[model samples]
Structures are given as C-alpha cells and as structure tokens.
Target: MDLDLSSAKLTQKKKNSEGINTQILRSICVKTYRTNITKHHIDVGDARPITLPPYRIWSPKTDYITQGLVHLKEQNIIEPATGPWAAPVTLQPKRDRTMRFCIDYRRLNEVTVRYVYLLPRIEDTLDALHDAEYFSTLDLRSGFWQVELDEESKEKTAFVTHDGLFQFTVMSFGLTNAPATFQRLMNVILSGLKWRCCLVYLDDVIIVSSAFDQHLKDINDV
Candidate 1:
C-alpha cells in the first residue's frame, strides 16, 4: 500500500511540473499601450455631440451598472466627465444573465477619422504555422483596458448615466481605431518574433514550435 501511495505522489508531482512548464509563457509581462493623441488624432470632423436619450434600466441591472462603474472608477480606468459630449449608456445582457455596461459609440465612430492600418492576412498567418507542431494560445484579460487614452481623447468617450457623466482614461471598446491601435501595439511588442515562432491577432497570441523542447524555449523567450 505504501509503495502504491509513493508512486501516486510521484505521478502527481510530474503532472504539476508539466503543467507549470506548459504555462510558463502564459504569464507574459507586457507594458500597457498608450494612445498618442498628439501623433494620431481622432478627428470628429464637424460632428456635434451625440446625446442619445437615456435607456431605462430595471432593478438588478441598475445596481450592477452602478457597481461596475464604481469598480472602473476605483481602477482609475474612468472618471467623472463634465465635457459637452455625452453618449448614452446601455446594459447589454450577458449569457450569465448579468448586465454588461456599454456605450452607444456608433455616432462617435461615424465622425472619427478611420485608421487605415492593414491587419495581417489570415491566410498568410496560417500558412506560416504549417511547419509548427506544438502550439499554445493565450488571451489577454480585458485587453482594451490595458491601453491608456490621452487626455484630449478621453473626453470624446464621455457617456451619460443616471449617476452622472463619465469618461474613460483607458481605451474602451466601441472606438473606431481601437482594433488597429491594438494590432499596432501587438506588432510592436512581438517585433522580430512574429512570423518566426509567434502569431498575434489583437489580444490573441499563438506560440508555435516544431518540437516540444523548442516550444518551451520559444515560450520562455516570448
């Protein structure tokens, strides 16, 4: 009985070690991307402030929205806005039956100057992985929030709520050039590693390698 227990313990230890090795690159240290409003302008060309009528919220959703706003405020991701611009906030129902706080930025996107940066061709990215055998995929948590918006551009994201007006300090979803900006950041971060052993598409990162040992080394380098 003792021999069996000892063997089981060794097997569990091996499994744990393997798990740690596989997840080594999962905790990559990346710096937050900051939007250069001075260099890249979001021109709202003659488009007046779009103040959509406020949407009514029921009991639990209202509480959830308030809590969400408070959490964002605490994280310094958003702050009270006194700007003339105001977009109405809405609660998008999640699969879990919870409310997702969202701002209707359609009008804002319409007037903003579109970014023309070309995204990577899916076929090209996939073709490069033909030689790869081992693969590990990673997803950034709240990826958009990892980017900071410039002071001038923050006000442009101002939204109205029952609590008051608020603007994002970090880049929020629904912005026109957000994906392009994120892709640009990813390209910059991956630099020389891209098309070599790493494939990046916005917040998703896939590390590829032809051999297991090479995969471990590549993941560590990333």
Candidate 2:
C-alpha cells in the first residue's frame, strides 16, 4: 500500500525523542528521494505520470553532450521527458515558449577568458603512482571556488558589457581549461605521499592491494 503522510496530519505532534528522531529521518529521506528523481512526479503528481511536467528540450552546445544524448535516445538509455523528437530552436519567450532547452552556460557553467595559467602535467601524476598499492580519491565538488584568487583572476571570469554583468561562485563547467587545473590539484596532493600503489580519479578512489592491512591504511589516509 502507498503511504501518504499528508493525510495522516501527524507532523510536529510527536512528543518523545525517539518519535521526533524517526519523524525527522522519514521526512529527510522522502525529500532526498523526491528531489533526485525529476521535476514532475515529486512536485506535481505525487508520483504519477499523468501529471508529467511540461515538455522540455536541452540545447547543450558541447558535442560530447549532444552526441551522448543522441546515442542514449537510439539505445534507450533513458526515456526523453518529452513526447516527440523535434529540432531545437532558440528560446525566445515571445515565440510561444513551450519547450525548455538547457543553455545559458555562464553562471550555470561560469564564463572563461584567455590566460596562461599553469596546470600540472598529467604524466607526472601517472609516474608518481608507480609504487603505491592503494588509492583514495576525493574531489572537491566545486574545487575551483575553494581557492581564492586575486582581483585580477576575478576579472578573467567576468563575461561581458552593455549592462553591468556576471560573476560565478562555483567553478563552471565550460571554462576553457578548468579540467587541467583540477587534474593539477589532484597531482599535487598525490605527490606528497611516498607509497607507489595509489590510483586517484576525481572523486572515485581505486585501491590495488597485495595485502589487507595496506588497504585499511589507504582508507585511513583518505
């Protein structure tokens, strides 16, 4: 049977510590499940397709993304949110906006500018991993935003003119060379360790082991 807490009206009525804790856990779990699913079922349908969200399109300019979507549609990786396949058009609100194309890469993925920033070489990182038997990989979610830059670097991130415009709090996806910068940071962190048996990917850690105790040590290091 389906559970409907809304009808129960039992919220905020719990008196004991255990009851309150249970209620809190239940609410948090429900919210996380709903938010991660999609825009439709959680907000509109109470989990029914009959109330699907408005049809939308995503116009990502990057070829890696575009081709991935096309492959997914053909191979049935996931169902499209919309009813049919149609060519994407620019979003002009006055033009009877029915579709939502995912663009506007600036703040969502911050703007970039020309620069000679030093990024650590990937080969050096690979060589440094020659002896370790375990690796613990952790990635800063919004790594670029973690380090502070001078006022000069701030200007490099700004987009453009006519109106006073644009800045970013997080490291955006489309910045020209941000990937290299992130890899560089990873290299730097790994360089300090003497073990030759570690493998670190952005957030995924892979540990190679000839022994059990070493694995625990690797886990502890991370």
Candidate 3:
C-alpha cells in the first residue's frame, strides 16, 4: 500500500552510479517486509514479501490534452518541422525500461505543453541559507491530502475505475495543478521574508536563523 519514492538510489539525479540502486531498493523492500510482518502478526514461515504490480504506463489518452501549432521552435527540443502546416500526432507515453516506469508527456516537449512548471532555483535556496549556522525544516507528510478540498473541485479530482465508478480523495499530489496550488500556499506562508532569511520550497519551509524564540514566533505567525 505504500507508494514510497525513496526505493531508488539516486532519484532526480541526472546520472546514477551503478549498483547503488539495487542496494537502495533492496533496503527499502527489507524495511517494508519487516513492517508488514510485524503489523499483520505473521508467523516466521508465512511472512514473505508479496509480488508488487509492475510499474505501469498510466497515460491512457485523456480528453485534457490539446493540439496546437508551435509558431516558434528549438533545435534539440523537437524533430525539425519542415512544412508550414503540421498534422496533430497522438502523444504516446515513453517507458524507460531501466527506470521501470512510464514517463508521461514524452511525445511532446515540456516547453510546448501549455502547463507552466516553475522549478525552485537551487541558487536562491542556497542564498537563503547564507547567514545561519543551524537550520531546521518542517514538512507536512502528504501535505496536499492534508488540505481540505472544496466540494465542487473534489468531484473532478478523480480517477475512473474498472467497476465503472470514478473516485477521488480530497486533494491528491498527482493532480496536474497540485504544484501551483501548493506553491501558492507556501508563498502565502512565507511572503515577506528576505531571500537571505527564511526560505520555502513547496511544502518544505526552513528558518535560516534558528533561535528557539524566533522559531516559535515564526511557526505561530505561519
């Protein structure tokens, strides 16, 4: 039941060191194995890890994708378009066999995708940590789901089921616009702080100056 991201050795890394992933994933499986054994009160003979469903390709054509011509282009971003008029192509999910997962939105470039994703600047994050000798960060586990959803939006935030019913939880992380909503919340919480002072990256917020008194006040303010 756990959708743990830490099983991989070097997630989000451009290139992973060989053999590192196997060790890390094995360690995660061991922990999951141990936890389930203890929780279910399984006998030594009966306690064995169950087979996980293979990582799946999830982009089963949705009605959400739109087709439009890109008036401008980049060289490596897409195959060069020779003609004036371009026919719409059905986008296919790209599966990385080594990663054992499907990468959504692979047939098109991210730049052309209409959806805007703002990656937090690593330099800005580092700059925020300049002065303080100590740092403490707070993260709400499954923070998106923690927030209550409005009734109207809740219905649309759903998935279709094999049983013919579509289902949704309050507000899940995998939703397309979750990042922007989460970013808004974070910005509101730390609005006026100097870039060299307190900093926030999505659900993670940290105080650069870590005095007990100041920390308590900041938490209260947020």
Candidate 4:
C-alpha cells in the first residue's frame, strides 16, 4: 500500500510555475508508508467475554465467509480462536459486488471499556483550514487493520464462522472504541505537525498550506 494521500487537490490555486513535484512527493510517501505498516497496537481494555452464536448468513454466502476467514489466517491477520468471547461473522456486499467480511460485535462493544481520547470536532477541523489555499488528503489503507490488537484484546474480537472460531490479531472494524483508538494513533503519529500545518480526523489526514512549496514540505513532515 502506498502512503501517498489518495488525492492531492490544488484548491483555489494562485497561478504559479512551481507545481508539485510528483517524484519527490512519491518518494517521501513511500518512505512514510514503509515506516508505519504495523506501527499501531490497539488495547481493548478490560471487558468480560461474551460468547454469542454466529449470525445466520445466507446459505450461499457461507462459502465466501469460509474463504475469507482462511485468507485472513494465511495473512496472519487472524488465528484460531478458543477464547470465551465469540462474535458472529456476516457478509456485506461491496460496490463491486464482492463480499466484505464483517464481524458483529454489538454485544462485545456494550461490555468493553471506552477510550476517553477525544475525537476532533468537525467545526474545529474545518476552522483549522479556514486560511488554506492548498489541501492534500491522505487515507490509510485498511485503516483499522493497520493497527494490531494487543494479545489480551485479540480474544475479545473473536468471531465464529462456518469453518471455525477465529480472532483478529489486527484491529477489526465495528469495535466501539475503534474510532478513539485510531484517532489517538493518528494524533501521536502527527503530533507536532498537527493543527500547525495539517489536521487529522481518525485515519483521514489533511495537510494545509497557503504556498505550494510549503504544502509539499508539510506532506513530507506528515
């Protein structure tokens, strides 16, 4: 996965010959991407285990679910689970008509301890960009999956599938405190640069600048 922001927009650009240097930006982005592939670890905090029956998926969809679980195991993203917690797996259709493997963690989320780290308010985020002329937005691929779950927290993310029970070693979607955890990680990664040159809301990072040269440098710093 590349770290280059999904899209870089020259919003309301002032006419100038100094356009962005793609080669320099791409080089910096690749370096940043390599540095943070599995940098964040998620701690689910203290919670009692709740074993819930697997949700009934359509009979035809079971095969896809099985394959999905196996794929995750192959990548070491998940492992065989034998813990007290068991959530149900379900398949959601993607825009491309592929199955999106999902785990229903409503019961587990209800009992899990919440993270107090505050997410940035929308108004505040917008306010920070009031004076910016150039903007670049960066998105992390598989944002939640990029973060690993701590050993004790992994079992709490267990999900039952037709093949067997499994738990995600990396943070999975649908956890209650996921947003807070991810936001916290992003904040830490962009501490000094945040608000000064860029703004972060969870996995979405925005680098703002009034000049093109400065914007490129800001992206490098992020």
Report lDDT per candidate.
0.77, 0.37, 0.39, 0.75
Candidate closest to the true structure, highest TM-score: 1
lDDT of 1 by residue, 158-222 (tens): 89888989999888898989888888888887899998999999999999999767876777777
Residues 110-169, model 2: lDDT tens digits:
223333545534686666766654333433334443333333233233322111123332
Count of clashing residue pairs in every prediction: 0, 7, 0, 0
Better of 1 and 2 by lDDT: 1
Q: What TM-score goes with each of the models?
A: 0.83, 0.37, 0.42, 0.81
lDDT per residue, candidate 4, 1-222, as tens digits? 333433444344422312344554455445212224333343445655688887878898788887887777777789988989898887889999988878888887777767788888999988888889888777766677777777767888888888888888887788888888788778777889999998988878888998877877886677
For candidate 3, what is the total of clashing residue pairs?
A: 0
Check candidate 4 and list the clashing pairs: none
Model 2 segments more than 4 A misplaced: 1-139, 159-164, 202-204
Q: Which residue runs does candidate 1 get wrong by more than 4 Å?
A: 1-41
Model 1, TM vs. native? 0.83
Error (Å) of candidate 2 at residue 176 is: 1.3
Better of 2 and 4 by lDDT: 4
Residue 135 displacement in candidate 1 (angstroms): 0.5
* Candidate 3 residue lDDT tens string, 1-222: 123335533335412332343453344344211111111010123222221222323354332221111211111112232222221223344464222111132211222223355757989788666666544455545555444444333333222212122222234434455666566666655678635456777767776664544543443344
